[model samples]
Target: MRQYKKVLLGVASIVLIIVLAACGNIDDSSSSTSSSGKKTTSVQTTGQVSKSEYAGVIKNGHYLTSKARGLTANRNSNSLNITSFENGLLGVSKSYYSTSNYIFQEGQYLTTAKLTNWLGRKSKSNPTGLNPKDNGKKNSSRNPIYVESIEEQDFMQKNGNSLVLKGITIGIAMNTIDYYQKIKYGATYQQTITSKERVAYGKKVAKLIVERMRKIKKIGKNVPITIAMYKQAANDSLVGGSFYAKTQTTSSNISNWEKMNVENKVFPEISSTSDYASNDNKSFENFQSQIENYFPTISDVTAQAKYVNKKITGEQVTITTQFYSETEIISFTNFIAQVAPKFLPSGVPVNITVNSANGIQAFLSRSSTQRNFKSHVFSSY
Candidate 1:
C-alpha cells in the first residue's frame, strides 16, 4: 500500500492543557442513567490529567464504530482524498458539535447499498442515483458522475442509558475530473468538470439526500445536519481535496450556506500561484533550501502545508533519506527539530516524518498549544 505522505492527522485539533494556576482543572465527562432508571457510578472526575476518556460510550478508552462499518469503502478512488475527506469532516463538524458535549460515531444511517445506488447514474430502476442518466454519447457535459460519493458522520449525545443522535454531518465529494471507458478494455476518455457545474450538481445531491434521509426511519426528520461540499483533487494528486463550502438544514432543505477556505497545498508550489500569502511560501522555501544545501544525500524533501482562511494551520514535512543507520537518522531528525519551529508556522502543530527504505525512521511533532516539539528515532540496529 502506498503511504500518503501528506496526511498529518490531528494537526489542527485542539490539545487543551489547563495548567490551573488557581482553580482545579475541569474534566469533560458525561452522565448516564441505567436502563431500569437506576444511577450508575460516574466515571468522570475533575482534576489533573489522570487518563484518556470520552463521554458517551459504555467503554471508557475505545470509541464505538458504527454497526455498519466499511460499507462505503469503494466510494473513493484517490488515497489522498479519502483521509482528508474523513478527517476534514470532523474538523468541519466542530462548528456544529462541540467535542466536550458530543461523542462521534461512524455514519449510522446510510448503508453501503444505499450509497452505491446514490453514486450510480440515475436510472428508471435506480431512481436515487445522483448522477445524470447515461446517454449513448461520451459528451463531457452529460457523461460525468457529478456526485462521486457520500460520507456521513453521526454525533451522539448521552440521553439516557444509550447515546442518542445530536447531529449529522454529510460530505458531498464531487469529482473535478471523471474518467470513463466506453467499451470494455477500450480507450479511456477523461472529462473535466468546471467549478460551477460541480457545485450545482453537489448542491442538488445534498438536497436530494436531505429529502431522502427525512423519510428514513432511524434518522430524525428535522435533525440538524451539516452538509459540506468538497471538490476532490485529481486521482493522482499528492495533496488531498479541500472543503469549499458548508450549510446546515434550517428547515427541510439546506440553508444558511457559508463558504469555507480550508486547503492543503504543496508548500513550494504555492510560490507559482497567489493562493497563500507570500510570507508562508517563503518560509517553507527557506526551510526546504537549508535541508537541501546541508544534507545533499537526502532523497526527497516535501511539505504539505494546510491553510485555513489564508493562514498556515499545520504543515507535514517528509524527509526521505537513503541512510539506514539509526545514528544518522537521529542526527538528521535532531537538526530538523531545532530549525523546523524557526522556519515553519509558529505554534501550530507541525509533523516531520523521516523515512528510509526500511520504513519510518524517525518522527517529530509539536502540538499547536505547545512551544517545544517532541522527537522519536526508530531503532534499526
Candidate 2:
C-alpha cells in the first residue's frame, strides 16, 4: 500500500505541473497584449469599438466641443455637431442625429498652424495659366494666390435606412484672379475659360493636400482624401461652383490620383425623362443584340458605343461599327441610321460611323451637316 501511494503522488505532481503550465501561458498572452497597449478583452470581444460607445465618452468633452465649433465656423454651416469621440476616432452629424448625417472624422490630428501651412503650400502650386497677371501664360506667380478658406468635414452616404461615413472631404475656396475675370466677363461661355482648365487647377491643389497628409504619422495609411476646390465668385460666395479629385496613399506611398472634374452635374434624379439619365451601356448592348438577330450576315461586325454629356449641347451618343468589307459599309450605315435609332434612348443625338475593311470611313449624325464620307477614303484606295 505504501508503494502504491508513492506512485499516486508522482502522477498528481505531473498533473499539477501541466495545469500550472497552461495557466502561465494564458497569463503571458494577456500580459503581452497589455504591454503592447491593447486591451486584450476588448480586442478579443470586438475588433472595433462601436460609434455609440465612442460618443458616450466624449459627449460632454470640452476640447472636442470647441473643435466642433471651429469646424462649423469653417464649413460655413451651423449644422455640424460632434456627437462622439475616442482616442483616434470622431463622429459628427449635420442637423440630424442619424448615421446618414454622421461623418467619421479622424486624421493625423494636425495643429491649426500645420493645417494653415499645408494650405499655403497648395496655394503656391496653383498653375500660372489660371493667374490673371500671367494672361494664360506659363508664368506661375512666386507668391500664388492661396485658398481663401479651408475646411475639413466628413460627409455621410445613405445606405438603406441608415447613414454611413463616406469619407473626409477637404473643401478649399480659392479666389484666383482669373476666376473673378471669368465671372465678370462670362469668359466661361466665351471659351476663354474651360472646365478642363479648372479641373487641372483643382488637381494641382489636390496633389499638395495628398503630399502633406502622407507625411503625418497618425493619419490612417489607407484613408482616402478628397480635395474639393470651390471657386469664389465676385459676390464673395463660393458660387462659381466646385471641382474635386480623390486620392489615397498606397502601401508604396505612390498616389494614383484620378483626373479631377466638375461635381456630378448630370442630375439624373431631376431629369428622369431625359435619355441622358438612362443607362447608355445597357441601351448599346440591346442595340447590338438586335443588329445580330436582324442581320446575321453582318453579325460578325464589332460595334462600340459611348455616351457623352455636354453641359451646353446636351447629351450625345457616338457609335462606331466595323465592317468586314466595303460592300457591308453601306448596308451597315443604313441599318444604323434606321434600325439603331429605335434602340437608342429618346431625345439623345447619336453619331454613327462605319469603317470599311478597305479603310474607308463614313459618318452620319442626327443632323445632316455631319453626314459625310471622308475625302481621304477615295484618295487612299
Candidate 3:
C-alpha cells in the first residue's frame, strides 16, 4: 500500500508541470486571435469592405432673410442662410462658425457632422453708407505702364503734360511720369503747393503706385512695365506746357476721363481681357468637365460609342490642358488611354488620340495651325 502511494504522488507532479506549460503558451500566442505562424494584430477591421464604403449623414441648409442685410451659416446642420441682402450686393461681411465630428475606418474618416451659425441685420441701400468707414469714396489708385526701354527722347516728349498710349491704361501711364517729374523739379511754397505739401502728395502717389505694381508683379512677374515721363516747352510758352503719357496715373483721374470721354470723345482702347481670361481661367471647373467626358472606357473600336455622343456623328471632344512640358502631356494622354478601357462596361469600344496642339489651340482664338490640326484628326473620326 505504501509503494502504491509513492507512484500516485509522482504522477500528480507530472500533471501539474504539463498544466503550467500550457498556460504559459496561451499567454504568448492565443490571446483572442488565431496564430497562423504570422504576426497578429488587435486592430478591428475585417478587411471585407472598402474603407470608403462607410457612410454618414451630411445635411445643410440656407436661409435668406427678407431684410437683405447679412447671411448666417448653420454649422450643426451644415447649412447657410442669407438674409436681407436681396437689395444689397452678394457678400457676407461677418465671420462664420462651424463644427465637425468624424469616424476613422481603415485609418480613413467615414463619418462626419457639422454646424454653422449666422446673424443678420438690416443693410443700407448703399452698403458703403452702412459701413461709415467707407463713406462711398472711390478707391484711389495709380496707373502702371510697361515700356521695353526708356530713353531720353521718350522722356522729352512726355515732359509735364499727360498723354495715353496703346496697350496701357491712362491712369497707370500718367502716374509713372509724375514720379520722375517731382524728383527733378523742386516745387515752390504756396500756389496750392509747398515743400511739405508736395512731399505728402508725392508719398501718397508713390504708395499707390507701389501697391498697383505689386499686383502687376503677381500677374506679370518681372515682365517689366516701364514708366517714362518727358518735359517739353509749351507751344505758346505762357501756358506752362506739359504732355503726359496716354495712360492716366490715378483712379480718380481715370474716372474723370471716362466720364468726360462718354460725353466728349470716342477714345481708342485695348483691353487685356483676353490675356487675363487665358491665364486665370486655366483650372476653371466648368471648362475641366467639358473635356473629361470624352475619355473612352474600352480598348475595342466599338467601345468608343459609350463615350461618344450617340445623337451626334463623328463627335470629337477637345481638351485643352496646360502642361509645362510636352512629355507631361504625352504621359497623361497615354495613362488615360491605357487605364480608361478597364473601367468601361463590357460592350463599348473606344480610342483616344491626343492632338499635338491640344495645349496651344486652347489659347488661340482661331489659329490656322489649330484649325488644320483639328481638320486632320477629325477627318478620320
Top model number, lDDT? 1
lDDT of 3 by residue, 1-381 (tens): 000011111121111112221322122221233567553422221111333221111111111111111111111111111111110011100000001111111101100110000011113422211011222222222221111011100000111221111111111111112111122244311112233433333334334333443354222323222222212221222111112221223222212111111000000112334432232123222323333544442111111111111221111123433332444544445444443333322232222344433223121111212221211122211
Q: Sort all candidates by lDDT, best to worst.
A: 1, 2, 3
What tens-digit string does per-residue lDDT give for candidate 1 at 192-288?
A: 9999988888887889989888887677687788898888888778788999999998456876579998878776773366645567778888888
lDDT of 3 at 19: 25
Please name the candidate that would achieve the greatest TM-score relative to the true structure.
1
lDDT of 2 by residue, 1-381 (tens): 000011111121111112222322121211123577863321001111453431210111111221211221112211111111111012112212333334343221444444444433223443322222223422332233334444565433335433344445455555433222223333321112344655566556656665666565644455444554554333332123333333433332435654333321221123345444346545555666666554445323232222223222222333334445445655555666676556554443445444435444656555323333222122235
TM-score of each: 0.81, 0.32, 0.15
* lDDT-better candidate, 1 vs 3: 1
- Residue 12, candidate 3: C-alpha displacement in angstroms: 99
Which sections of candidate 3 miss by over 4 Å?
1-256, 259-287, 293-381
Clashes of each: 0, 2, 55
